[model samples]
Target: MNPRILLWLAVGLVVWAVIPFVVPRYIADLLVFTGIYTVAGLGIGLLLGHCGIVNLAQATFYGLGAYASAYCTVMMGLPSVVGFLVGAVISMALAYVIGRPILRLTGYFLALGTLALSAIASALFFEWDWLTGGTLGIGGIPKLDLFGFLLDRPSRYYFFVWIVAFACMAVARNLVDSRTGLMLRAMRDSSTAAAALSIDLQALRTKVFVVCALFGSLAGSLFAHHASFVSTQSFTVDRSISFLLIPVIGGATSIPGIVVGALFVTFLPELLSKLGDIHQILFGLALVAVVVLMPEGLVGAFGKLRARLAKRGGGNG
Candidate 1:
């Protein structure tokens, strides 16, 4: 490992440790959501950046996980781990079943298919009020208890959530650096050539899609436990759109970019809300600015700037 990288890691650890204690309770709460969003957004990032797939059905899996956790913990009186496992299994299963046909679609058509899936899932969540609790939602979801330690506060929960996010990020990094990642990139850049090489395109795409759903499910379960409630409103098409934006706004290919994007998504709205009702309009404009000016996202733009500075230093040297 690089000494500089280790140093930066140490600094980051110190900062992370200090933040919750220094910040207001609400800000700490937002940080928890940022971590949750990062986990969810990572799945989308993997698909979009590596597989060249725009998955808009992430919210469906997210809802499934939340509902699973909610119903199991509250209604069935099952253990929380059971709910997490059940949600992950169901989400992955659904993704496999849906990805087979939809993965055949190219570009916009594929995107639309995922969007339609999200719409159908949202409708089902609303209609199946008996199980889902519909507009009223499921409540009294219990907080996680690791051994005897209770994660009842936002600050405590923040660490647990981000740890999970980091684990997911590590998995994504491994995937991106592996042979399957090479196949994905080859397929993304030139599908014909990849196919000529006898790569199983559909299977590969479905595999990534299933992984994406798993991440979504995990994030949703985290959200359910953190919020202590699950509702149809949180799992709508709009939420899926927001998840999509995280990868786009941060840099789809960069793991750290997911964290950056989650921070932007979680904190920006709160910052803008101070300006009253115009916050929504301002937020929209900000997003447009990011998309138009920094097409590769904030992380990419920073990388470019860093390269430029290094070049200038070398020239001077």
Candidate 2:
């Protein structure tokens, strides 16, 4: 392992170890949601960041996972863990089926296609009365039970979500550092050149799309189990947009940026709740400001600052 990666792992371990003791239950719950979004955001990073594919229909897969998990646990009487796995498989299969045609479109056309997919998925969530329970949603989904232990408390769930989130980050990091990651970067930079080099553009695109959907599905499954509920309102175009914003806001190129962006979005509303009606206005302005002032996003900006400081220190020495 790289020394820097090892150092980061050590730091992350410390932070995780300290969070439960230092933070209150409410804050811990917020962190739990943050973890869920982090996993989802990492998926967004893979598609939009690494592959330069704008997947505007991410919420479709997310909804599939949540609905699948709900149906499995409630109707089929399966365990939450099994439901989670089933949700992932369903999301992957659906992404493969839908992504093949939709991904064939590029740029704006691709975006539009995904937007249409999201709209259609949202409609189905509302219209599928028998299976999805329509707008009424499915409730009483079981809590996650691993072996004999049950994650029924906020603190327990906080740890569980973070564990899964970190595992996802590790996988994403591995992908980003491998030859496949190199191919993704090349495809993103210039698909034409990549294709000319015989890079199997279609296969690569489809794989990343499925991977992104898997991450979203995993997050959704966790969300359903966490809240013990599933609703159409939870997965909307607006929500998909939020997931997209996460990588952009946090610096799509950096894995840690995804988590930072996720936490920022998760906590932003609560932090601004004191402003009441003006909170929405403030949130929009804040996002706009971030995009305008820091085109490379928060993590990229921070990295630049760190490099500048290091240069100054080297000069002084």
Candidate 3:
């Protein structure tokens, strides 16, 4: 690795260690959400960036994980890890079963199919109030105990959440650098060419879709523990859109871009809210600007700017 990269990473680690202590409690709380969103958005990033798939059903898996955690830990009195595992298994199974047929659709049709799945899941979350608690939500979810150390506060929870996010990021990086990633990209660029090359597009896509579901589920489980509540509103279409935006606004093809996008989604809205009632309007316009002006996202645009500056400096020298 480059020495400069190592130096920057060390600096980032120092900053990460200090942030929870120096920042306001609410800010620390938002950072926790950012980590959770990073986990959720990573799957979308993988599908969108590598497989050229637009998945809007992430919230469905997210909700599955949240509700599973809520029901297991609160209602069934099971361990938190069991809740996480159950949610992941259910989400992955659903994705595999649903993806087989849905993966057959191409372009906008596939996008719409995923959107419909999100909508249906949201409805089920509402109608199945006995399990989900509907508008009332499930609460009193206990804090995690890691070797008798209670993660009862935002500062403590922040470390756990981000650790999971980093782990997920590592897994994503591995996938992206693997041979399957090449096939995914090939299929994305030209399904016909990939097919001619003997690639199993359907199975490959379904695998990625299942992986996406697992990420979403893990994120939801994390959210449940952090928030101590789970509700239908949190798993709605709007939330799904927010997850999609993380990759879109952060540069889908970049692993670190997922963190950038999560920060944008989590922090920008909070920062804008200080402006009062017009904050939503401002945020909308800001998103529009990002889409219009920086089509490749913040990370991509920054990379281009850095490259340009380097070229200019070299020319001057």
Candidate 4:
């Protein structure tokens, strides 16, 4: 929509395309991590942006995918490709079943229920010794092989991640322009009015919930394969908080906002961690300041600033 922003995105893609080729493997990894976080955040955008659902159990879907892949590949001896798809399907079915009842609630009640689900999922990951290896997590996840070709190198894996990230963004953009996306947006804006007009509120919310779960699962599958390990710490309540934090910080209404928010939240912290305790304190303070100053979000603030400058210029003319 904004030509300037489109130009910026095109430039960014160009940078991303060149970085792995030029940068060291370890540094390239941080960018990969950012991409992974953005992919997961886009799923949160689908629910929070389009569907207007604050799903507190998002990390459960993520953990489910990681563990599912671990179980299928490491335990069941399945191929990596099969294991990945299986992970997503398992998360989808699980979310669909749970969302049936859970989707009926609204506001605080739905939040509370999803929060409870997050706790349950974490507990299972820790307690299910036989199935999940309990608190120890899973390691030595086999590197993916496409026929005779083995994708064991970091450079090769980078392509896998980038391609998926682009695909996820494309899918979200497409869905937002479709009939289902329109229905989700309408229901999100007002269930009461939607119900008045005969929208099946419960069914619609349930489907969106499944969509969130499926995307989260997709991110999780990539994560497990890339890291070659799965752990409860990697997909827990705090992790879910970070996932929610991104779209809110970026302005949930726009895809670019979520992507930017995810990148900032992911790498900026690690960069600050190197600067000592004062930096950590400043980071927290900065977060609070941003929330208070830009409650409508970063993109919203920028839009307002642009409008104000335009108005001032017109008056001077």
Leading candidate by lDDT: 3
User: Would you estimate the TM-scores of all the predictions?
Assistant: 0.99, 0.95, 0.99, 0.91
Q: Model 2 over residues 26-73: C-alpha lDDT tens digits?
A: 888898899999999998898888888888888888898899899999
lDDT of 3 by residue, 40-62 (tens): 99999999999989999999999
By TM-score, how accurate is candidate 2?
0.95
Candidate 3: segments with Cα more than 4 A from true spot: none
What lDDT score belongs to each candidate, Candidate 1 first? Answer: 0.95, 0.90, 0.96, 0.82
Across 244-308, the per-residue lDDT of candidate 1 in tens digits comes to: 99999999999999999999999999999999999999999999999999888899999999999
Clashing pairs in 1: none
Off by over 4 Å in 2: 1-11
Cα lDDT of candidate 2 equals 0.90
The segments of candidate 4 whose C-alpha lies over 4 angstroms from its true place after superposition are 1-10, 146-150, 278-280, 314-317
Q: CA shift at 242, candidate 4, in angstroms?
A: 1.0
Write down the worst ten-residue block by lDDT for model 4. 146-155
